[model samples]
Every structure is written in structure tokens, then in C-alpha cells.
Target: MTEGAVPLISARGISKSFAGVEVLRDVDLDLMRGEIHALLGENGAGKSTFAKILAGVHRPTRGSLALNGQPVEIADPRAAQKLGITLIHQEPISFPDLSVAENLVLGRAEDGWWSSVPWSEMTREARKYMDLLGVRIDVTKPMRGLSIADQQMVEIARALVSDSRLIIMDEPTAPLTPKEVETLFGIARRLRDEGRTIIFISHRLEEVRAICDRVTIFRDGNKISTETIDKVSDADIIRLMIGRPLKEYMHKLNTSIGEVALEVQGLTLPGVFNDISFSVRRGEIVGLGGLVGAGRTDVARAIFGVAPAESGTVKVHGKAV
Candidate 1:
């Protein structure tokens, strides 16, 4: 690895357990400057757990971490930030009621409380990163009103402001559309070009090929292998991640229709899902799926009347449910 002759961060002899059940066994990981290392693994693979240790969210039951080859005790997240490390969560992270500027500088406001939030300086810094991310939104707006994609961009912007050397992005594109994904990849490229190290975690294999330089696989909580993207295929990654070959991703199709089990129309929640419409047949399951905060549960609740709906209609078994 041209850039990784010396890793910015190296972890060795790392082991973690929960309730006496071993999750990670002396797993090793390294991130070099200006490199995007993708971490792949199936559910329960301990991928997130390892990332948390680096972010100071969890301390490994047994392990040693060296930042720039110097041992450091990551006592808390603030310590991680002090070492120029940050983690962009798999889900959107933000303060709903806080303005974009406030959220960006909440923890480390300017040195002095006297005009601690210099409006111009805050906007300048926030805009610099938002522009770098190619995302345009009102910086003064409260985060509660922004979409998930926009919120994620703000999170990255926050990391940049903190002078982060290592940015760990967990499922960064999980909620984005194709175009939004492209924008994220572009931001990642820009970060690498600026000599930053990133640990890119995503479930999608193609995204790994598209943006990552090196790939690391975790299966059953152990580091399987690390290699350049050019040397591996999606099939190979899946095999290592799942401990079995993924025959194909497009293997499921339906040629028959079942009876109607559910029918919902005019389902309404004033501040949530409004007048949503859908139908499901008997012995049928309709997966109400979408990005978080996309009204998936809101729709379900309206149908179930878990909360009183503002207005709407629902039909289950030919009767209003």
C-alpha cells in the first residue's frame, strides 16, 4: 500500500466479550493516512463493535490501540475527538431543535464564551464543509426539519470542523438515493485527496468497489483478510463476509399473487404519514420499508391505530380496522 507504509492508527490484540460470550478475538485493524478502508461483515459480525472502540464508545475487554504508533487510552469519546478521530454514525446524528450552526459547534464551541458563536466564523466553517460535501441547505435552520440525507451531510461537516484525521462512516449511503450516493462518494474522494483517513463501513458491495481503496472483511468477529479493491470481486467479499458464496443477489421473484390480507387507503396522520395508500392480500406480507423517519412506522401506527389518526380509512378482512 503506497499510502499505508505507516498506518495512522493500528490496533492489535483486540478482544471483546458481552456477558461472557466472546464477540471479537484479538482482531487487528489498521488505517493509513489518505486511505478509505471498507469494513464488511454480516449481522452479529462485530463490525460495529470494533468501530465503536475506535470512536471511544466501547473499550475492548482486552486490546491495545496506538495512534500514530503511540499508545493512548481512549477513556471517552471526548478523548477520541482530542486525538483527531471521529465516527460518522450509520444513522443520522443531529440535535433536532438546534440550528445547523449550533449542532456543528455544540461540543467545542469557540474558546471564549464572550461571543463564543461568532456568526460569521461559524457560518464560514460550516459552509466550507457543506460546500465541500456539495450539499446546499440553510445553515441557520433547525435540524428537525432537514431530511436524513441532509442531516448526514451536516454530520460529516461536523467531523471536518473538528479537524478529524480518521472519519469512520458506518452505512453512509444506506438511506440515500442513487444520485445522493454519488454526491457522498464525491465527498469521500475529496476527503482522501485532502490526506484524511476514513474507515468506510457499508453493506453494499458495489459501493465498496466504487469508492474504497482497501477492503477488510470481518466474519464471526475476526479479521479475515485485507486487500486492495482491484484484487477482489463482489463474490469474493460476500464469501468472506457470509462464510458462504452468495449465489446471486437477484434470485428472488414472484409469478403468483395471493389473496388480500390487508387493505389501507386514506390513512392519515397530520404531522406524520398523511393519507398513505396501500394494499396487501391474504397470506401476504407487505414490507413497509424506507429510510428512518420516512414514515414507515408512522404508516403502520396509523393503520394499527396505535395512535389516533387525524383522518383516514383502513380495511382489514373486508372490514375497517
Candidate 2:
């Protein structure tokens, strides 16, 4: 940020509570105009809560918010949209049965109650924004079977339709392939160059360093630090986020081995997961670690019967389930 440049959005002494449990306390943040500011924190941190307040999904329990140096009351999602603020959720929200064009202009429709929707005009306008994002898709197709990447593009186009100035993207790259992530990054940079402010939330540290200009760290519902991305190393950010050194968290544990408590044999979900076998013994702690979309959740789901395996045997306490 330039010296003395006023913030586009300023959060002062903000706090939030749910059912008498405080989630955020006296948090202060400033988002500069036309910059991609990354919000970093572990699970259960107040990062999402703070972003909700900005997007009008939740109101602050205390403190105030200012836009362009003027105080504003963001009552709801509609109010946020009217204020040129839009939030694209981690899971893209759209009407599954509706066509892409209809989903794009659904909420911000210009026609009156009795006025007929001009499909030709709406499709033309929707195509314009999609083109701006360099995405090509059939606007007449239902949104149900579209890929996650395509769904995300539709959400971005919705923001453009509303003439949004500030867009908050919550874990936008979680479900995307590596190539799709690069494409999304390019679109984000283009948005920034066009003078739009973006609040980027992600757990991927490398992605943060690759695309964001500044970052804010959150821990236990408190604002820890905000710094330029280039000035802070990845290890420093991880320490701040977890409140400990990485080595300390990675220290090995010493324990006695015991009889097997759970076992899996020949678990297969075809393309999802195949030939997986593992066992967990009593008095032993085991971890299933993998990158996103690596079928970790699928394996768990199969074990739990959420999705049954085609060929597998799960034994619990020496008895097959």
C-alpha cells in the first residue's frame, strides 16, 4: 500500500460470539484498494467468521465497520451486494436445476414482478462477463453436472453482473486441479488490475505467496499480525498460525504396540480409490495424510458406509463389519 493511502474497508475492534462463546475479540484489519489480501488461519480460527461479517452473512457482536472512511451498516447478503461486496463461497452456491444464464442473474434480476425476462438480453450479458473471465461454457445447460471449476467461474460472473467492487473468495482453489488453479489466479490478477479489491482466504501457503500482496494471520479468534507477503517467510507464517514451531508439532511420540483394533483388506472404489489396505492397532495413533482430492475422504466414507466399497473387508475388534 502507498503511504497514507486510505483503506477501502476498515474493521475496528470487531468481535463476535455464538451462543455465549466468543469467537473473535477486538480484531482490527484494513483492506487496501485493488489488492489481494490473504486471510490465513487453521481450522476453528475466526478467519471465516470475520470474513462473514464483511460479507454481511454475520454481524459483529461489537465494534464498527467503515467503507471508504464512512461508517456503514451491512444488514444482510442483499445489503452487501448493494454495497458492491460479494462473497464466493468455498462450495459454489447456485440453483442446480436452473440454466447457467438464469443462475447468473437470478438474484439481481432487473425485471419487475409482472415483467417478462428477456432471455436473449440476459444470455448476451452473461456471455459478456464469462468472456471477460476467459471461460467458455454453454449458458443453456443446467448447472447440476458442471465441473467445480466451471461452477466457480459462474459465481465470478455473478459478481460481475452485480457490479461488485470487493469480492471475498473463501478457499476458491480447494477443489480445483493445478491447471484450473493457475487459470483462476490469472483471472484474480486481472480483476485486481481492473481496480477490484479481493479478500482471498486459503490454507495453501504456497498459493498465498504466489498470488497475494499482503496477508493477515489469525489465531484463537485474535488478530496476530498483518504483513506484506514478501517480508515474511512461510515458516514464520506457519509458526504464527499454529502458535508453535513446525518441528515441535512434528516431534515423534513413543508408545507401546498392541493388538490390532481395526483392519481393512482390498478396499477398492475403482477410479476413486483402489487396493487400499491398512490397520490400526490398539494404543497406537495413525494418520491418513494426503493432498486435496487424493481420496482420503473417500476412504473414510467407504469405511463409514456413507459410500460402500465394491470389494473390501473392514474388521473392527477382530470382527468384520
Candidate 3:
């Protein structure tokens, strides 16, 4: 951002509290025009809370917001949309049963009180936005069956349809494959080139360094520092986020392995997962590691009964669940 130029959006003295527990306190941030600004912090660092305030999902307990140098009150999500702001959630927030085209223009439909739904026009417009993002999908299909990457693309298309100047993308790459992540980054760069500001929130530091111009680190509801990405190293950023050197937290511990506490036998969920078997001892801390769409989360979900496996036996301390 240029030294003398006014910010595109200015948040001053922002503070938020939920049930008397403060989540953010006297926070300040400036988002410049035509730049992808990254917001980085650990979980419960109040990053999302700050973004939600900007998106009108939550009002600040005390603060002020200025868009284009004028004070404004964003009372709700609809008002935020009217102000040319949009939030693309980590999980696509759209009607599961609605068609892709319908979800793309869900809230900003143009149908009047007596006018008929222009399905053809809607489809065409949605296709145009999808094409701009280089995403090819059948716009007539329901959103329930679409891949996470495809759903994220649809959310970006919705932002384009709404003519949003500032788009807040919260963990947009969390569930996307590497190829999909690169594709999404390309689209984000295109949006930046077209003079749109983006608030990119992510845990992946490498992605932030690759795409963002500036980064703001938050810690325990406080703004730690805001620096140009090029001026900071990864270690520097990590220290700022966690308040300690990385080496201090890298040492591993040894523990005695006890009897099996969690055992899964022949866990299968058809195409989702196949014959997954694992056992964790009472004193063991097992990590489930996988790439996006690798069915790791699916296996966890099935074991937890959120989505029961078609054929599996989950035993907790020797008793089947």
C-alpha cells in the first residue's frame, strides 16, 4: 500500500465480547485496495471473529468501520452484500438441494413480485462466472453431490455475481486438492488484478507467503503486527503467532504403549474408504494424516457415528460400538 493513500477499509478500536468473555480487544486493521491481505493466527486467536465483524455476521462490541473514508454500520449480512462485501466460508454455505446456478445467485436473484424466474438467463450468467474461474460443471445439478473444490468455486462465482469489491475467503483451500488450490490461487490473483481486495484467512503459511502482499498476525484477540510479506520470514511469523521459537515445541516425547484403547477392524465405506484398520493404545497419540479428499475425515466421521460405515467394527476398550 502506498504511504499517503487512504485505506479501502479501516477498522479502528474494534472489540468484541461474547457472554462477557472478550474475544477481541481494541484491534485495528487497514485493508488496502487491489491487494490480497492474509490474516494469520492459530485456532482461537480471534481471526475469524474479526473477519465476521467485517462481514456483518457479528457486530463488534465497540469499534468503528470506514469504507472509502466514510463511516458505515454493517447491520447484517444483507447490508454487507449491499456494500459490495462477500464472505466465502470454509464450508460452502448454500442450499444443498438447490441447483448450482441457483446457489450461485441465491441471495441476489432479480425476480420481481410478479415476474417469472428466468432460469435460462440465470444459468447463462452463472456459467459466465464459472467460466471466468475456469471451472466446468453442470449448473443444473444439486450442490449436495459436488466436490469440495467445486463448491468453493461456486462460492467464488457467487462473489463475482454479487460484484463484491472485498471478498473474505476463510480457509478456502482447506478441503481442496493441490491442483485445486493452485487453480483457486490463480483466480484470486485475477480478482486482485481487477482491483478487488481480498481478506485471505488461512493456517497455511506457505500459501500466505506465495499470494499475499501483506500479513497481519493476531494473538489472543490482539493485533500483534502487520508487515509486508516480503519483509518477514516464516520463522519470524511463527514466533509472532505462538510467542516462542519453533525449536522449543519440536521435541518429541516417549511414552509406554498400553493395551489397545481404540481398534477398528475392516472399516469400509464403499468408495469412500476401504478396509481401514487401525489400533491406538491407551497411552498413544495417533495422528490421522492425509491429503485433501483422502477419506481421512470420512473414516473419522464413520467411527464417531456422524456417518456410520457400511461395514465396520469399532471397538472402544474391547467392546464394539
Candidate whose TM-score is highest = 3
At residue 77, give the lDDT of candidate 3. 90
> Candidate 3 regions off by >4 Å?
110-117, 269-272, 290-298, 304-310, 319-321
User: Whose TM-score is higher: candidate 2's or candidate 3's?
Assistant: 3
At residue 220, what lDDT does model 3 achieve?
96
Cα misplacement distance, residue 239 of candidate 2 (Å): 2.5
**Please, what is the TM-score per model?**
0.88, 0.89, 0.92
Task: Give the per-residue lDDT of model 3 (tens digit) for 1-321.
Answer: 578788889999999999999999999999999999999999999999999999999999999999989999999898898888999998888899989988887647533411355889878877898888887988989999898888888988888887889999999988887898999999999999998999999999999999999999999999999999999999999999998989985898787889999999999999899999999998888998876679999999999999999997999999999
> Model 2 — which ten-residue stretch has the worst lDDT?
107-116
Clashing pairs in 2: none
Candidate 3, after superposition: displacement of residue 299 in Å? 3.3
* Per-model CA lDDT versus the true structure: 0.83, 0.90, 0.90
For model 1, how big is the CA root-mean-square deviation? Answer: 2.9
Quote model 3's TM-score: 0.92
- TM-score result, candidate 2: 0.89
Each prediction's RMSD to truth: 2.9, 2.8, 2.3
- Over 4 Å off, model 2: 110-115, 256-260, 266-299, 306-311
